[model samples]
Target: MEIINFGKGYPANVLLPHTLMQKACESHLQEEKKLFLHYGHKQGEEKFRELLASFLQQNYKTAIEKEDLLITCGASQGLDLICQHFTKPGDTIFIEEPSYFLVFKIFTDRGLNLVPINTGKNGLDLAELESKLKAHNPVFFYTIPTFQNPGGTTLQEEQRQKLVALSEKHDFLIVADEVYHLLDYSMRSPFPFCHYSKRVLSLGSFSKILAPGLRLGWIHCCSTLLNKMLEDSVLGSGGGFNRFISGQVYSFIKLGFQQQHLKLLIGSYRLRSGALYYFLTTILPDVICSPPEGGYFLWVELPKGINAQQLLERAKKHGVTFHPGYKFSTQKKLNNFIRLSFSFYDCDILEEGIRRLAKCF
Candidate 1:
């Protein structure tokens, strides 16, 4: 079978630069080998923290400092630690109806009720959010403002401001899942939540843009909340990260090889996204699809009365696969929609896969 798997959000075909590895190895060898091999600070490497803080301050123009950041195993861990520290059984949390699945699982397993609001083209429906907030009074509002998962839509500038206003008025923290913040295809950069850092808790990861094997992620928030979350992380998982991977990542960053690699990665994804969109527009004319401003996935709505799950079975028969949209919804109402990732396939493969699905529909 000629398989075209667009089911996951991993870089489809990129290799770790041998130069980066050699540099890291050289650095590790220069140091006391035992220190490099041993455990690191639970908060993460200070040098890495400095690098992140400088970048965040420059990009987001926030008041964030080194003390405000907490490194984690991945952004997933940051989300988990937040839930662990702030929420309890029966607590109510708010989320956009079509959000990332793991987020829904986290809240559900913690016994927290989720209030999901419908999102509009520009992003979360602000008017609906105000209405829901007034009625349900949730503990926190979760959002993926930049290249949001499943929908692959971005929150407009006005909506970003409105969300911050809503958080303040409702007296709730805004949990911003921003692991894909840097993946915008547009010339202009998307707005990050750090502008409202005091009220907005942001999470980011190297897993999406960089390599996931590094297992490095970080959380940004006010010192009070961050300290609390850090204490919990220490108790639960202990502070130091995967020591070897940390050293590897540190060396890569120090050598400045990842920067050039990132540009290449983005350029490749941009081409892939354009190719995927072209295929859908030409091949799957009947499918309702949104052109993502930036991100890996294309969110498509099948014709009314057609079941996305059923289509997935047919697609699998054609040796193509993508995630069913219902998985992203807590209420499981988006059964007509599906998410197809373009980052994992070349232009030819993407076109072929779309052609296969087009035949089935």
Candidate 2:
């Protein structure tokens, strides 16, 4: 039997716009091939940054200056760069109890200590956050605040401001992974955390909105913090990271294809996520899960007395797979939970996966 993969969060192959990207690359080559081939400014290509700032400002509904943005190969590289510049080995950093599972590896590779902050249905546990802050000073609180991976929950605006204020008072930076900001079905993405304070660094990637192979992303921080990144030896020696990819992305956004393609992604994902959620609620009424509003995942809590790992073992026999929630937890405690991704398959396959998962119960 062909296994239905509900655990993978990658966009479906049909969803990738190869033709659109080809057009962008061809346009860039026709206009200015030699400039992109040569070394770029350490910060990035100047006109590219300007275009991106305008694109973000229009979408974010807040002012974003080119000076505040630094281009990167991708969000993962951006995080590594920030950790290298701002954190030392053995320094403490806070993360959500259940976060983007892969993020732990980046911090662990850098030798930073990880602390888990409880995340709830609403968002981060603020009281728990303050209590921990009293005991240990963290170099940064790295969080995926909007449409958090594996959780699909967003931090409210009030809490966002409070968190920034705490960061200001404690003199710690807020590293926000906001790569999913643009895929909002609601169309009104929360104003980014960087808007609240200079101490906040927000990461955005074209991987989620466009194609992942481009490996193009940007970091938004105040000019002061941006300079620290600009001075990093990697960029100083290598010039801009992914200069050629940045040029192609610049053309993509300039041609208005980015906006149009983004709309297509949002509409398709909305239907896919809704179908998965509907099938689950209708077929398996006992399971508990939140309705997905945006992003790639729907976090489900199995009925009491059912362990997700055991369910997965049986689910494999039925040719369906999902990520057991323990993988996302810092403390290894959410054994009864599972994370399902609606972005990788269409509604029919999603419905079938739910049915196969039901048989495991």
Candidate 3:
């Protein structure tokens, strides 16, 4: 039998817009050759930033200007660039208890210590956060606020506002990973975190809404931060990251292809997430999992006396696999949990994957 990979958080091949991307590339390249084919601007092509700003304003329902944007190869690169400039090797950094697992590697690779803050379906535990804030002065609190990975939680608007205030009070930056912000399916998350303060740096990526292969993303921050990076050697020496890719994407957004593609992705993922949730509940009644309001993942708690890693071994034997929750933990604790992603497959495959998981149980 075929292995069903519910742990793989990737866009389905069917979901990728081949035609739209081809059209964008063909249309943009067919135009009069310009500086985009050369070293390009250090802060991305100006016209691309202008179009991105307008698209973001309409989608997020908030105001942002091109001056606030800085282009990067992708969100991961943006995070690494921030750490390189803004942090020291031994500085403490706060992250959600179960963050995007790959991000844990990013910070750890930079020799930064990771502190796990409590988070759940309701969002960040502010009381616990404030209590911890009294003890550690972190460089920044790295957060995935909307439809967060693994947890699928969205921090409320009020909490976000207060979080910004605390950031100012404590003098720590707010690094918001907002790649999943526009992938909402009936979820009304707060406005982009960068809007609340200049201390907040919001990272947006085309990897999610568009195609990951494009390797285009932007950091939304204050002019001070943008100017600092613009003058930095990483950008000044090489010019903008993904300049050519950004140029082609200018047409993608201009032609209204991004909006149309997002709508299709949202609709498809909604059905898949709901199907996975339904199967888990009906087939294995003991498992505790909430239906996601948006985003790609479903975080599930195993039944009593169940260990996720041990279950995974059995699941592999049954031709299904998922991410054990401990993989996402900084302290390696949440062994009774698991993360399943619904973006990679259809309902039929998800159902089979769940049934295979049930057999493992």
lDDT measured at residue 95 in model 1 versus the true structure, 0 to 100:
94
Q: lDDT by residue for model 2 over 202-243, one digit each (tens)?
A: 999998999888889999999888888888998888999989
**Higher-scoring candidate on lDDT, 1 or 3:** 3
State the C-alpha lDDT per candidate.
0.78, 0.90, 0.90
lDDT digits (tens) for residues 49-131 of candidate 1: 78667765654555558777888888887888888888888999999979888778888888999998886455688888898
TM-score to true structure, per model:
0.92, 0.98, 0.98
Relative to the true structure, candidate 2 reaches a TM of 0.98
Off by over 4 Å in 3: none
What would you estimate as the lDDT of candidate 1? 0.78
Q: How big is the positional error of residue 8 in model 1, measured in Å on the Cα after superposition?
A: 1.7
Q: Can you give the lDDT of residue 190 in candidate 3?
A: 77
